[model samples]
Target: MIPRMGAGVVRNGRELVKGMSAAVPIAIGYVPIAVAFGVIARQSGLPFAETVLMSMMVFAGASQFMAVQMATAGALGMEIIFATLVLNFRHFIMSLSLMDRLKDVPLLAKGALAFGVTDETFAVAAMDEKGGNGRIHPLYMAGLIAVAYGSWVFGTVVGGLFAGVIPRSISDSMNIALYAMFIALLVPAVRKRWRVGAIALIGMALNALFGLFLSGGWATVLATVAAAGCGTMLMPREEPPAAEKTAG
Candidate 1:
């Protein structure tokens, strides 16, 4: 059964409201960025329908922006698909992290809830102490997603429709913003492992070399696969902790 707040027992709808409240910050941030994506997409030659559909279906903000940028860079359709898959591989870890918290949820409920998980949503839900003593209810998560998702789509639509009024300079710069985000995400991991930095440069170099001869997106796809395979072989495996290794 879903947990409740207060003594007398609150309704499920109330939990959803709490979730919406929690997502306010995410909505605020998403709107401007999403709006920027909208304007950039329109300026980048994506039609309104495709722009909105990408948001609606993909729902991963960083990957969406990257997709648009890659398309602009002459990446082929298959290359774009493969790139997004590699980038979003982190979703596997995120989903696994939530498994314990939502373990008892029915499979269908789990499926619905998983669809709503994002970096923001996961962070919010992980820290949230709602639903009685640090538990998260499916409904609350649903509410959180509803607001965030709506804001993203709404901002995309607004930007797409208003692309003309927005300065061409601003929309053009959004193409570069996604990589800035990537750098921010990359810096922390690079700090942990120099191999990560080496692997990244290797991928970049490989792409450049391959792009000289390959067409469409195959160069990027091949480069990514090759770099990742090298990382797997070169990066050291993490051993079990000393205490855990000795416990049994």
Candidate 2:
């Protein structure tokens, strides 16, 4: 059997409180960014109804931003739809892991909860500790997701309502918040593989190098390709333990 840990335990009321507390900065940072998304969507000629509908339906911050951008760029509807599918393909893997953790829950409840499985929610849920009996509480996972869902919905509304009031410089500064959120999400995962860390550093360097040379969004696309290549090449593979010799 794979080694197990209390990876899903809240430990106590305090740990639950701590996890919720950590989510506060995420909420605050998301406010301005979500607002920017709404403003941009509105500027792109999507009416409030359509904008809100996309937010509610898609429920993915990055994918929604990318979708709006592609739409604004006059990409075909099929292209936009395909791009969203490719971008969220990771969700399938995350869902499998979440399903194992939440296997004991009722099917209806599991189906409803699965809708909230975003990157942030998946990260929180994946880290929940296993219990002595190896079952993790679905409620803890739900609690984590509920906290993030509140922030996302609330931030979308705030951004939609106050988009015009946000200044250009303030909007520029918000980019740092995005970087901060990425780092916060990344650091923990980095501990598992030095190659992962190295690839990230290399990707950042290459992205900067290409950003200086190329125009438009080529830098991001190139960096993503480079990172994927590096990860596939350098990430370690685990080997199965040898079977014990039979006693003579």
Candidate 3:
């Protein structure tokens, strides 16, 4: 069923392949971060099984790390829960955008698809327009999720088991990988709107200023909120296709 269609059809295999292809960057992108999570989780005194299980269930890198840190600090259960919720609020917005793209699908399909709704998948799927040549195949999302999800889980286990073998020099370098991943993710939007460059610059400036002025983590939240608000306000309107412009 997943192999029979083309780019314009949601069921087309090509679209699925395209989706999977797009997800490749994401798969590679998460490796270092996911490994770092496992490393930190192990270092934090969490049992290996518990660490892996957390990655499996939460499957959310930042929130999982934050939760473990809070837990290790003997923070209250409610505090841990609140922290996780706050960290995951962005995913809720990502999911909402995905829902509109998948509006024509069946409820069961949507429900199942929602399980795979990570930030990476959301970013790729948002590029697909309904009834367009690059229409999103529901199964493509399924396949991409399967691969990316497996990489994350696998990376976590490997990182946890071999955390000791990874040298400090290597571990320190892994942090840069996150910024590279983000740059790749933003490339598409950047291509579409040069104005996005301004948003990113402003957001980074505010983030640095806030981090210097406020407590740790407050800068991230404030800068993100401010940048998103500003980006939305300055977002460019869709221009007519070149062919349409010529016809007119």
Task: Compare the candidates by TM-score and give the number of the best one.
Answer: 1
Clashes of 3: 2
How do the residues 21-122 of candidate 2 rate in per-residue lDDT, one tens digit apiece?
Answer: 645655665566677667666666677777777777777877777777767766667766665675576788887778777777898888767887888777
Query: Superposing all C-alpha atoms, what RMSD in Å does each candidate have to the true structure?
Result: 3.6, 7.5, 5.7
lDDT digits (tens) for residues 40-126 of candidate 1: 988989999999998999988888987887899888788789878887777878877775677678988887778778888898988
User: How do the candidates rank by TM-score, highest first?
Assistant: 1, 2, 3
Which lDDT values do the candidates have, in the order given? 0.84, 0.68, 0.75
Error of 2 at 64 (Å): 1.5
> What number of clashing residue pairs does each candidate have, in the order they appear?
0, 10, 2
As for model 2, its CA RMSD to the true structure in angstroms is: 7.5
lDDT of 3 by residue, 1-248 (tens): 55554434744666567767777888887777888878777776888899899888888876776677667766677766665676577778777667666667888887777767787778777776656744456777777777778888988998899977777677656555456656875788789888888889888898899878764455555776788789888887679999999999
Worst 10 residues of 1 by lDDT: 1-10
lDDT of 2: 0.68
TM-score of each: 0.81, 0.67, 0.66
The alpha-carbon lDDT assigned to residue 93 of candidate 3 equals: 79
